[model samples]
Target: MKKILVCGMSQNLGGVECFLMNYYRNINRNKVQFDFLCNSESCAFEEEIKHLGGKVYHVCARSKNIYQFYKDVNEFFSNHAKDYDGIWVNKCMLNNIEFIKYAKRYNIPKRIIHAHNSNNMENTIKGKLQGLLHYIHRRSIHKYATDFWACSRDAGSWAFPKEIMKGENFRIIHNAIDSEKFRYNVDTRELYRKRLGLTNSFVVGHVGRFQYQKNHEFLIDIFKSIYHKNSNAVLLLIGVGELEDKIKEKVHSLSLDNAVKFLGVRNDVAQLMQAMDVFVFPSLFEGLGIALIEAQVAGLPSFTSTNVVPQEAKITNLLHYINLNESAIAWADTIVDSQAIHRELYVQASMDYNIKSAASKLELHFSNICNK
Candidate 1:
């Protein structure tokens, strides 16, 4: 068996975490046993991973300067590097330079950095500076990494500009979801909506952390516009983050307490997806919108921003690309139209973006890498 070490920083149940967990569960574990290394003692996916028959090693990485953490991580890698054939780094986002460097120092044959977002690379001077540093570090460590996988083409391009264009050791592998778990069933939808007292309402749901990237302020604006036109329309914001209070305050200020509901950190996301009439994901940016694809698998119509990758926009007519400056009224108008649509075309679109298919692509890549 090829022993693989899956290392990650955060324990929060976000898009990147979800993707890693799915990969752990669905990979050909008999041929490749995975050992997870994480910073958190109680990650949201911990129990699920154990249930999947994988081993977990808690690193509990912490440091006052973050530079010290690298020294500690390097020591850990030195002691443990021989046990694993390859290392899969998840969310190698902002603060994983040291880990990458240490992997290189230890001479790991296969090091993969899987990026999950486009992440505002050109947003500010500081962002640009960091991007330059990241680009430099990535290139310096290029010899150590046998391959690079990105959740979307945009994400891949943004994170590995030179590597991708040069056709050197890069692939765009999107995040996956279990279609069996998020299957389309009308009865489940009706039952969930009725249980939630939303049987009479046209439900517009979005499942994601209340982070700046999600642009909750703009989400509230759009929800307010829709509520103003139709009081019976309900907005479901499922998932919690720093912006939760801000969003709640905005809803209260708009006197929309009844129309908008905050369901934080739900365990039944798949069932909830079925209960919705439409899914609104107007995220400013995403590596790949897993929730949007989940909505697709649930046979629910979705609307997203132009910033989201077109590949993820499974239902072309349902999706609208609007500038950030676009009014909430414009988003509302589009949502209203999306809710009115009755199309089978979207169901076909959903199948085309199945998570199993995405996993198959990854499996092929793994086979190719081992062969080479």
Candidate 2:
């Protein structure tokens, strides 16, 4: 079996984590096995990874202590780098390239740096510095990583050099999922709606961490406008982050504590999508909005920001793009009008995102690398 060490999985079940879990569950283990390496003690799908015969390792985060970070990574790679054929570094930013550096130092044949975000979401000084650090490390990535990959083209452009993005070593790996799991079903809608006590309400949903990237503050504002127009309209937020408490404060300050439900870190996201009348994703930027694609798969009418999200995300016509500069009331007006669930043509979903096909290609790629 071709064993590959997958890195950059954090504690949260965010887009990058989900992308890993989706493919991990489907890939043929006999042909290729994956062992995860995270900066934290454990990752979101720890139990599943262990159950599937995959191992999970932890290292200190570079942001917390640079010395310990280097020491831990060095010790780990020094002792265990030979256990795998390659190291796949899945990252949202290029703030740290030590994993690729160490992989190359250890002579791991295939070193991949996979990008998962288009840009930094924070507007603060720290965010700017992080962006600059990301820019500074792109050359290091180009020098050390044998393969360059991204969730989308936009993400590749953000984290890699132009030559790498256009070269043979680079590939755009679509964030494929089990689309059938998210396919709309009226029965599922009724089940979850009754369960959540939204039987007679218009449910507006969003699934993302309450971070600067996801823009939970603006989401709440738009929901406030939605509540004014129709009190029965409710917002379902699924995911929590450091900004969650602040967002809760904003929601309470707006007198919307009862109308918005904070459903954090759900395993049944597919069913949750069915209970929604609409999905709103106002992210400041994205490598690829996997949740938006899931919303589309659930056949939920979605509103998104086109300024940063790639056009490849327009898999279905149910997705609507809105400008960030527009007022919350304008967002509310558009969401309320366009989300009447008037999907005309059921387009065939037999496309590249099917998990089976992606797994096959990934396994083949890994197998080819090992054979060479």
Candidate 3:
């Protein structure tokens, strides 16, 4: 069997982590044994990976001694390179160029880098600076990488423009999922919602890190508007981050303490998706918005911003998008009113976002790559 190494910044079960997990689970393990190298020492998916027959390495260097840490990582990669057939950088978080150079020194073949974020110079000042630095690094590292995988077209266009590419070594491969978990059934949804204490009231849910990038503040404003127009509505926020306190304060100021519920980092996201009637993602930008797809699989109506990837989401009956500057009140009114009348649309959305089909596509990609 050929050894395979998957490297990423963290192994925590967020969007990227979850996507990697699903990929690892579905790949042809008999032909390719897998190893995960990540910064975080412990992750929620550690046990799951171990159970599925993979080795997990905690290689994050957080010490003040930068030179020593670099030397240590270089040595570690040098020693382990012989055991791996390919090194797949999950995203551009790892020392991709350095890894490729070291892998060459050790004669490791097939260095691949995956791009997962759509951020660019146009988004933020910090993004602009990073873009300049990334451009330089990409120029330096482009030759060492055998493949550069992008998660979405938007992510590809932002990270690897035509100027940096050699015609056709880059492509978009969506993060896959296990569709069986998100099967839409009213009985199952009702049971899950009842368990979560969500009564007959219409529920709007958002599942993502409570970070500035997610635009949680704007989501809160939209929720407030929804609550104002629809008295029997509730908002459920999943996941926790640095901005949890600020979000709570906003909810309190709006006097929505009773109407909104915050369920911290959850392991049962599939269940929560089933519990939700609708999913609202107001992120400023995204690589592929996996959570929206998850909600779609659960047959829940979704709403996102215009800047998100896979613009086809707007055409899906299960999702709607509004401009960033649009009135939250109007957006909320449209969502609530349409959902009330169009009940059958939810089932169609679930079928459209079928995880099984996505997973099959991923399996094909993994097989094709290994064959090449």
Candidate 4:
């Protein structure tokens, strides 16, 4: 059996976390087991990983304490690196390549660096400083990483050298999910709608963290326009982040307190989608918008930023693209017009995004590596 140590789980159950969990849940554990290495101790899905027979190890945050972070990381690999056959280090940016660096230093037979974002969308000083290191380290990523994986072509270009990306050692492993899990359901939708006390309202939903990358302020502005056009319009903001309070304050200041609801970190996003009339995403950039894919699977009329979010995410006809520079009213107009779309529950996402098929292929990937 091949035990693959998976890194990159964070405090939030965000897109990258969901991406990893999707594969971990679908992949055959008997053949390829997974363990987690989290920078933060309080990671999402800790209980679930333990239930699946995986171990969880914690390391200090490099951003908070770089010296101790390096010492602890080195100690971890020194003591336990031999217990695993390979390391799968997923990243939104190349700010820290030490995970792969140490993995190779310890002679882990296979070191995989998976890219999950097309750009570094950090806004803070520390983040910006760390983000600059992405450029510094990316040039030499090929030196340590034996395998390269990305969510999309754009993300691959963002993370690795062009020649390495074109080689057999690389692959575009998508942020695939259980498509059927997100398929729209009428009964479940109605149940959640009533639970939220929105039995008679036009619901505009956005699922993502209230972070710079998600552009929640723009989403709120769009919702403000939607509210003005239709007083019954209600905006449902899902997920939590560092900027949640700021977003909530903005909603309040705009006199939208009564019209917006923050439904943080939900487990039943599919059921919640049934109650929504349209899905809006105006991200600054994305590797591949996993939330957009989920919205399309739920048969929602989804709107996303063109050029910023790669076209690879638009697998269904329901997806509509608008430039981010467009006015809030312009985006609102498009989303408002989509309210009449037949909210069906039988939509099928692209087969490539299905978790079972993706899991089978990943199993073979592990088998090939372990057998080598």
Best by TM-score: 4
Residue-level lDDT tens digits of model 1 in 242-357 = 77998899899999898898998777998898888888888878877888877776777777787565565554454456666679998898788776577332243343355666
lDDT, candidate 2, 1-372, per-residue tens: 889999978998888899999899999999889999888866888999999999998888888888988999999999989999999999899977888899999988889889999998677899899889898998667789888889999999999989898899899888988877887778888999999999999899999988899988899999999999999999999998889999999999999988999999999999998898899999999999999888887787899996878887888888899999999999999999965566432233446677888888888888876677
Q: TM-scores of the models, in the given order?
A: 0.89, 0.96, 0.88, 0.97
TM-score of decoy 2 = 0.96
Q: By TM-score, how accurate is candidate 1? A: 0.89
CA error at residue 204 for candidate 2, angstroms:
0.2
Worst 10 residues of 3 by lDDT: 343-352
Best by lDDT: 4
Worst ten in a row by lDDT for model 2? 343-352
Of the two candidates 1 and 4, the one with more favorable TM-score, higher being better, is 4
lDDT of 3 by residue, 17-110 (tens): 8788776777666766678876556765888788889988765454445676567668778778888878877663222355566666777677
The C-alpha local distance difference test score for the whole of candidate 1 amounts to: 0.73
RMSD of 2: 1.6
**Candidate 1 residue pairs in backbone clash:** none
Q: By descending TM-score, how would the candidates be arranged?
A: 4, 2, 1, 3
TM-score of candidate 3 relative to the true fold: 0.88
lDDT of 1 at 288: 77
